[model samples]
Target chain A: MNWLMVVLGALAGAPLRYLTDRAVQVRHTTVFPWGTFGVNVTACALLGFLTGATTAATVPPALQHLVGPGLCATLSTYSTYSFETLRLAEAGAKFFAAANALVSVLAGLGAAYLAGALATALLG
Target chain B: MTREHPEDDAPAPGPEPKPTGWAAEPADPDTAIDPWPPKPGRPSRTPAREQAAILSVIALGGALGACARYGATLIWPTDPTAFPWTTFWTNVSGCAAMGVLMVLITERFTVHPLVRPFLGTGVLGGFTTFSTATIDTQRLLDGGRLATALLYVSATLAAALAAVWAAAALTRRAVV
Candidate 1:
């Protein structure tokens, strides 16, 4: 695999994560972590497409290193999710905490499924 | 590091004692300071140059973390229908490290502030991912492996949370 692809993708992914996180938080004035949720779904969609295309042999697996594990993983975070969940629980926003987890899982799966199907259709 | 924020060094707005001897052993020393976790978006006392340095460090760590994750996936290239054990373990372990690292830096150690953002935000953040886990589960469910999908999802979530909690608790008990 082209290791540079991983580095290149991360160079883009990490900064994009920071910028997108800041932008999302700036726009939404709520306790809900729209920032992390937004990036998680977006990255999942991209990962799904990458998986579909690579598994189908429509795209070189090397590119998978760049987009799938590199960009998507860096762009999406679990620490922030866990931290936010802990924070919400500590703050007694139990409902919002549950809602955040449920919504993130549901939306992430939905987006990934759709994107994977679309990639199969277009690339495969 | 730049000291451009003269106001920041001129005695913080909060009533915390100055870094006397660079060691804060309060009478209790039992709790993390209130107003803990400096507000996001609030500019740090570090100058723009130092902020840039920390950002670059984060980026460097991100590249290394991503490569490590990619290597793990390559070692065990599972088909889409199978449970992605590689990703699951990667996330669980990463979160566990994060829990320990955060407590060590924030509570136990008095290192540079940038150290947390660099290692925690950069390496551990990049190494662990929630998005790929969700997508993998969706792929399994779409492939009609509902049981496997459910198992993978719940198992990963539970493992990750437990790992973090256990690691954090262990670190605190040892240190404090």
Candidate 2:
């Protein structure tokens, strides 16, 4: 039953990622991979929220499996983010690449913290 | 400053040196050796447009890779307080596979340009994740498994970097 939910969630998450990435590409001309960055940060926040909700007893175990494993896994990315940063640095945009990396890490953590706190307050 | 003569860049005249290996004159005088070796009845060059086509193929491949990652997690659910085995294995296996496939496709087989984007950039990029790894390690630390979490965090980072290096080296060996 939990496995079934995971499959369904992945189905939804994967296509959503693809569509969102495409949309972001159409809207922006920046060389940075904003689509991937946005998705990953959002996913991290969602994971945090879900974790908090589950811990607070507001979300069920099964739902946690679906959203956390299935949806979150499909939504977040790390390899592309790393590879692109390296490419940018190699192409002589070292400062920009380093800033991008730092921002992603720090901002992602902040988003997760906010999401977790929000979920805890609202759900509890 | 006045510019130097173009002929000055050329090598000075010397006694004719004996050729080391193949005696055939290169097709391009600017290059000392043939970059592309002739194969029996095989074409010497690929079309330029093929490189551009790889991006779309990779994006589609990424979707599949992400889905596969979710599937692997489902099969091995980790306890909240314990080490995350599912993510660890997923990353390690993905890294190893990337290494092997890079060699086989880039060197041993005549892989289409589209295939590299699909498999290397899209699929592998999507399959293995570092964000989740970081989050999981932090969670483990927060949950009081400090030693396990530290080990997990360092191992993933070091191993993944090594894996990429190994893959690139293997591909170079097979090609050259």
Candidate 3:
């Protein structure tokens, strides 16, 4: 069941990632990788919500397997983040690279924090 | 293959396009690889038949990678209160492997086009997740494990970055 969910979630995630990246990158040509940033943070919020639901005992363990590791993990990526940051630094956009890394880390952490808190308050 | 200087014979016979870097989507809307070439430099390599195949490659690879991650979580299941070591190690290892894979594809080898979609965009993309890492930290912090949360967050970011850098550097030096 867990394996099936992972497959299903990732089937959706990989394409969504490509589409979102294309959509976000079309209008802008800067070094800041806004597409990846938005995708990562959005996935973080979703995963945080799932975690919170589990914490509140609202979501069963079996269901948690579907969205938490399944959707969220497949939806967001670390490898791309590392590469883009490296590319930016290599391209001499050191400031943008630094800012991208900082903002992504902070935004992801903050989004997850907020989602978890919100879920807890509403359900716990 | 002749080891001769045939550089002027119709654009050097383009090598099979491999995944150059992160997020090198084939169906990307903002493709700018060749602005002055008029029709761009990809339509021929991609053709019409290969485009659909690329999408399938991504889907299939994504499923494979996601299931692999799920298997890891099964082997190292973590409770709500415990550290999610499975995910941490997964991200770190995936980033490291990605570094090696990128260099191998872009520098050391000429791989098939499917290799990039299947491995780089699909498998590696699905294997290592930034979202789960943050949410795991949020879980720790919410449970009042401030120290653990801080350590986990910083350690993941630092280790992942270092892993990529180190692997890339080592691979480059070793190959060159």
Higher-lDDT candidate among 1 and 3? 3
Superposing every Cα of model 3 onto the true structure, what RMSD results? Answer: 8.0
The superposed Cα distance between candidate 3 and the true structure at residue A16, in angstroms, equals 1.3
lDDT of 3 at B137: 78
**Model 1, TM vs. native:** 0.80
State each candidate's chain A TM-score. 0.93, 0.90, 0.93
lDDT of 1 by residue, A20-114 (tens): 66566555446677877888889988988877777666677578778877799898887767655555554566777777767888888888878
DockQ of 2: 0.15
lDDT of 3: 0.74
Ranked by lDDT from best down, the candidates are 3, 1, 2
Question: Can you tell me which runs of candidate 1 are displaced by over 4 Å?
Answer: A55-57, A120-124, B1-47
Candidate 3 clash pair list: none
| lDDT of the candidates, in the order given | 0.72, 0.61, 0.74
Q: Pick the candidate with the highest DockQ.
A: 3
**Residues forming the 10-long window of minimal summed lDDT in candidate 3 chain A:** A22-31
Clashes within 3 Å, all models in order = 0, 0, 0
Report the C-alpha lDDT of model 3 over B107-172, residue by residue, as the tens digit: 788788688778877888888888878877777877899998888877887788788888888988
- Candidate 2 local Cα displacement, residue B49, angstroms: 20
State residue A111's C-alpha deviation in candidate 2, in Å: 1.8
Query: What does each candidate score in C-alpha RMSD?
Result: 8.4, 10.6, 8.0
